[model samples]
Target: MKITCVGGGPAGLYFALLAKQRDPRRDIVVVERNRPDDTFGFGVVFSDATLDNLADADRPSYGAIRASLAHWDELHTHFGGRVLVSRGHGFSGLSRQRLLAILQDRARELGVVLRFEEEVSDPGEALATSDLVVAADGVNSRIRERLADRFEPRIDVRPNRFVWLGTTFPFDAFTFYFEESRHGLFRVHAYRYQPDRSTFIVECREDTFRRAGLDRAGEDETVAYFEELFADKLRGHRLLKNRSVWRSFPTVHNERWSAGNVVLLGDAAHTAHFSIGSGTKLALEDAIALVDCLGAHAGVPEALAAYEAERKPKVLALQRAAQVSLLWFENTERYMALHPLEFTFSLLTRSLRVTHEGLKARDPAFVREIDAHVASKAEAQSGVRVVSADAAPPPPMFTPFRLRSLVLENRVVVSPMCQYSAEDGRIDDWHLVHLGSRALGGAGLVITEMTDVSAAGRITPGCAGLYRQDHAAAWRRVVDFVHARSRARIGVQLAHAGRKGATKRMWEGMDRPLERGAWPLLSASAIPYLPESQVPRAMDRADMDQVTSDFVQAARRADEAGFDLIELHCAHGYLLSSFISPLTNRRTDEHGGPIENRMRYPLEVFDAVRAVWPADKPMSVRISATDWAPGGLTTDDLVALCGMLREHGADIIHVSAGQTDPSSKPEHGRLFQTPLSELVRLEAKVPTIAVGNIQSYADVNSIIAAGRADLCALARAHLYDPYWTRHAAAEQGFAMEWPDPYRSVERYTLRMR
Candidate 1:
């Protein structure tokens, strides 16, 4: 078999050597566009985990790489004129030139032919006779460009500008220096790779680069400027340049990694941001995966598919982490206002991979210090003494949260879950038991399911409603029982299903039209929920007035029922959400077209409801932060909408996503909606309730402590375990209230100490 590899970087050389080692007669050749001794960049860093993989792949190469590495276990952050050091983060760095040389020597020893300084302008012509073509080229691969139509690459050039250079600083640990400048905030990511030299990367926002005149300056001048800026850490060491020029980091992604005989590897297929230091690690792992897949499968196409299937998800996860790290650097200015300890903690956990528990394991004393600091601040603000200096404080999830006149006992919220157990828009036994059980289970806030504003607005005949006095009276029974029996505050979600209404029960094919009776629906536009479903009437001025009046009546009813909060359900392709999303709202009137006009009716409805609702009681608006489809609402749009809602009178934003259209494809994962919540909370400067798949106590603790959201709502978790909050308290060793009747059971279980 003849295999031709393009680009003689680490990926190409490593794959060629591994393939040759697997079978000596494979006939592999590696082509390079640079001299064997020449390479760009200073050093490449790797985790101990990656070294284990290298050893498993080939012991000799792993030994060589390990021998050349400079190991460090500390991360130092120099900010606010104080250097904060975090310990137990293990990392190893090796010179890039040494790594390439090691791989080149191994490839030659394995009898794999190596070609250097021979650029193949057309990769297709160079590998025309080979049975398999490996495009292990760098980010600007000519092979990938030659087959651009087939590859379908998407390159996102990030906003921040960075330059990679080297210095003889001999830093003992991985260091990050943040210095405020007349231009802007400048940062350095520097770590020693050898005894005498270290890799120093200077980065700043684009405006900062231009303000500092580095955009017009030559490479030497740019280096000189950063040298003076970070001179304190450099200790008079001079900066060295090897083709160092400021450039925006391009994150490259490909729809497909392989086409017929040609397969992409490493940077040719994807490029992770350098902030995570996974570019070399990922490249080497790709080589290992490809060789292993080839060994496992007999056919080339099968091997390529298997390799892609095995490596893409892992690479994408790292790319996501890298993207998070990159964004943190880009927006460091926002976090600069935080206390130094908190700022360092935020930087450490920016990728979302690290958790409070993980950090605690790494440095228990540091975590305790943070907890004590937070406890002191909380005590000062609320005048509620908590956690004496001798004892550690409870997790952030257990801390009280105050909104307007309501002060929650904790941050845990029982998210509204649809029961679909109502009759003629009246609640029954199921509503009382379902909501009452969660309140008794010790959640700070308990929110009811999507209660329709009117009978015609119901998603199904079984949906709860608060449009009638009878409905209000029925809910009053449940609310009064919860208030009298537990310390939990109850909230009502008032909604109008709009285009999504008049459907069968969720168990009997949700969104399907009823077989016997279906009511007429009203929406922002006359669009059918499904192809065969009923087409809703485009709401005229009269229809809009009636709907708005229905919501106001519901709010009045909710207030009469003694609800603590009312969340306007403007999400999930419902009536108000339809008006917010362009995918659902298609009209030529003043109520449609541009976003401002589209938001007009929703704003009017909110204003009407707010005018009647008690000012002391907080109001929230649940919105689909993104439609998860093209030509739909985006995060930026949601930010603007949230700001408008805040101005009108929204106390909190319930952050949710998708379901705006049947074609919407949401990216689902654990705590997937939290990022949207974070964006809305920080960008719009409004308190946010993060919902969607937040199931664990650790998730709640991390999110609340990071200031990502003021509250976290759990939906399915509550359905499965009504005592989720109580059990979480037990897990965290924190005290929580349980029903007096269940005290004996709690004692038997030894949950309360």
Candidate 2:
């Protein structure tokens, strides 16, 4: 089968190489609109992990990429009298021109044609000649546009404006500099593309552009703006400018990524924010996934379908993560004034796919010191537990933190995730095994996902509940077993769905409500989650009283079931969170407007739960932190909100951002949500849980060790490997035993042939 890859950039060339290498006579050709050595961006980055993927696919191309790489290991982040230098970032970047030269040369070696300066519209140029047309174009693709209805693409215009340009400032390594000027926060992403010249990508929020008259500035003026802002770093070298113009690339994430015989790859598929250096990696991974599916299946349609099914989920996950990261960065003004150090730390962690534990291993001592600072503020709050690293346990992240009366052995918590396998708020073996496995996997605490406080409060019918005595009895089975067997402490996330109620099962469609009928939903106002989501009933004073009582009753049932902790689901666009976020709450009553007024209902729910909950048992609140929607609750708002929670007795602030609105712009990347969590934990001086794309053990270790957040919640990673903590321990070359009952089995497996 002949495969024609349109738009010959890294994605197209790499896909051609992978496809041709997979089947030596498949006949793959890459079409390019630019000359062989001409390209758009200055320097593009690829990770060490990206190199490994290359080696696994095509050794020859891997060698070519390796030979051309600049091998940058160090990254220096600068801002506010603080210069943080980190290592093992593994960003091998070079001039885009040089990268294309390498790919073009290697393509020729492999008998693949590199058609340069040749443009094609849709499949008009290659359709008659080729069997498969792979659209590997950068952000904008004519082929994708023609088939836009099929792909159902969603192009998000990001709030920040950036310019991809080169400077001869000798920035010998990758650097992220946040400078404060008369124009506000200016962020520059600069890295060495060659021995002498560096690619300088300057970024500023749209507000700053208009405020500083930057949109009207020319090339020379832009350079001067960067120089003046980063005055401390842009010393003698004069910060030379290139001819590249300043513009913003809309971060594109599509609901559909592939069509019948055609598929989108790289930026044309999903665009990760520049804040995370995965743009090139994302393209290469798309190539890898396609090749794997092709090798596994025979027919073109079958392979493309399988590829889309598998690749779309993974890419969407990263794209979602990139959106969260981008949102955090674009909201700089809200955070800079509150927690600059935590802000910088959040940005640093968001750039990689490392786990919390994995980050701790990279720099344990540094992480420990940061944790110390958080403990120092115990006196700042009145009845809240002080999370001292040394006081908890010598293992740092492995130490169990206590809330109210309940004690969690470690900082890693299995974030409450939906199983969608329950029957009418009743859990089954799947829920038990899912929650139990993580408990056995070594999470200090495991919280069940949005266990509805009432039948009407469920986002979906499959959501677990604690409103009834039987439901409490059903959960007690899992809690009792976990308590009797695993060291993991069990916590429940009680919530009322409110405006988001009566949704279908997660697997069936996710957001759409049931077709047969609908349940009466209650909210602060009559507003709905979106235009499509069912419009909900506006809660009156009596409805509010009942909902608050429902939460209180749920807390009482949880106590009967022997739970160690109770975390209120006041985030993720649920009932409690709906009432708190301005983007959703539009009421004229006491539960509306100003931060204090909006938080009234949420705080009332907290008090009701706290009153019913045992004093010894710990209670926490999970907040979306940032709505990701513009003009929503900023971290500044969160700081004040957190202070209020502290006053009313919140032990830990469990933070997971976004889901504020479907249209909310999120700049997601690795650990993108951690920064906002870090700020609330640090500046507010409260124990906070960090989440969002926390996949690896290192990430878990680092956040705990760094004190960016006391607890790191793993959602998808735990799903992929229930025993991730155990596997990570072995992967990191540390020895730990499974529970005595499972020890024999673990040992046998470890020694098996």
Candidate 3:
């Protein structure tokens, strides 16, 4: 297969390298506008996972990139004097020039012909030269425009104007500094590119740009403005631009990505707003995928079909996120003027790729602690999730359930996880695999983990929440595909963990938050999960009522999200559970006391939730069934509690165990607490879904067979095998609908059947 990649940037070079690797005999040429040494941008950051993807596709190149990487483990967020440094953000800061040089060398070594300083304006040059022409000319790709009607380019000019500049200052970590200059809330994303210089990208919304008159300002003037914005941090290190050739990057997005023999790759296909620092990653990844598709498929049309089909969703998602980042930066005036904290959080979320649930894996402590914040308990960010028959499988676990109107099928669920890979709060390529494969696994129900109800509810500095219009739009592709591709039902689990926060990630040591118990935990009563955790503030009467309403309103929003079932997280030691657990509830008010009293606030939460939840659909409650501590709640307590929940319109009782008490020793084992689920099933007489360590086909079938529970949820196992459901069906000789794409794999006629 012969291939011609236009533009010598990361995408083209990487694609050329990948193509040659796929077929050494294949003639591949990379045409660039600049010399081998010449390149734009300062540095590009790639996470550990991105490296793994590269390694998976082309290990030699992966090893080469890794070998040359300037590694950084921690990401530092600057808020004036307060510096929040969190570890394990996992990015290697390699300069654009360095990245190109490496790819240039790798492509050359891999037998890729690099034709530098060759500006061919016509597609005929690509057509005449190679079997396939990749339209990777960048954001303003003329090849894509020539076949504009074929590609269907939906060019969305982003609002915020940003300049990608470099500096010689030693920036070892990714630093986001907010400046409330007369220019307004200008945020600078500065991170190390080389050992001496850092890539300083000055990003500001349209309002700030206009107010500062940056458009009219000369290149040096903009740099001066940014220097003033980071006055003390710069430490006299000068910021430099390639001003001899003027460039202020306008974030570009295209609706239609590929057409005919020519296909778009990288920034030419889609541009991720600079906030998330993944422009090059997207391009390189496209190159990798296109090559694999060419190798995998038999011919050009099929390869193109597969590549476009694969890359389109990915590019669109990234573009949507870029749009969000662009809009958020452009709308900074709105957030900065009214809600600074929210603005900052929104910025963090916009650059992120994965959903809120992913944070549990990436940085559990951050997610936990954020769930413990004030807005978290307010219930404004969580509510009932709606799912239509038209809705696709969310993540992997999706099922058409039936309880009044709520229906889902399948038991596997992609527990919500966050890919804080965003610069601001947008989804990107990382998000696609982070989500799509989970759906591909055939889980009946994949509920996105606890998505922050509001931007502020996001755990860590990086949990992605759906609190804005751009958020909804950004997620549409994710939700749409899960529904279209699989039988799985998709739903978003929204949560606000109140006051249980302030720490590094889970792997880092899910530590007790900053100020420990001093950050004022808000609950029905003044109770702390532990002395090291925050000492929760006793909720005043006003707080209680307001929180109840917040839950209601958030639920309404969840309905707008088009989720299928609404699961109010009254479990996992979050705020709702705080009110239910005796260990945390010390109040004598209507919201606390005996089981009945303890049930009040949570019930009020449920009732408020019920008022907004549809009368027809089934509502579910996930509870810590047993608090484990003797004086806390008992299994009997959960049964009664579940009975009450059923009375309040909850259809499924998702039974789990402990969290509130520090001394609670959970009896740990495989399906150790399944008996508790049995009790909840028989006693409560409501459909019960059992979770925790139920990891096999036998377990799922037996649990449902023995009537211990109506459904069995397999979480960790699903992660281990996304296609577990398919494997299970084949094991059981049950005919399941395998996706059309994989049907060929089913033909094993050598004697097995």
Compare the candidates by lDDT and give the number of the best one: 1
lDDT of each: 0.88, 0.78, 0.67
**C-alpha lDDT (0 to 100) for residue 287 of candidate 1:** 95
556 in model 1: Cα distance from truth in Å?
1.8
Query: Which residue segments of model 3 deviate by more than 4 Å?
Result: 243-256, 337-346, 351-357, 364-369, 375-753
Q: For residues 110-199, could you state the per-residue lDDT of candidate 3 as single tens digits?
A: 888889898877677677766789988888887877877777666556455668778888988888777777767766788886688788
Candidate 1, TM-score vs. the true structure? 0.94
- TM-score winner between candidates 1 and 2: 1
By TM-score, how accurate is candidate 2?
Answer: 0.70
How far out, in Å, is residue 434 in model 3? Answer: 35
For candidate 1, give the lDDT of residue 116: 90
* lDDT tens digits by residue: candidate 2, 64-181: 6677677777777776677766555567876777777777777787788888888785476576677888999878888888888888888878668887767667776688877777
TM-score ranking, high to low: 1, 2, 3
For TM-score, candidate 1 versus 3, the one ahead is 1
Q: lDDT (0-100) at residue 27 of candidate 1?
A: 95
lDDT of 1 by residue, 312-390 (tens): 9988888877777788888788777767877787777777777777777887777776666666655654456777666
lDDT of 2 at 68: 69
Worst 10-residue lDDT window for candidate 1 reads: 744-753
> TM-scores for all candidates?
0.94, 0.70, 0.50
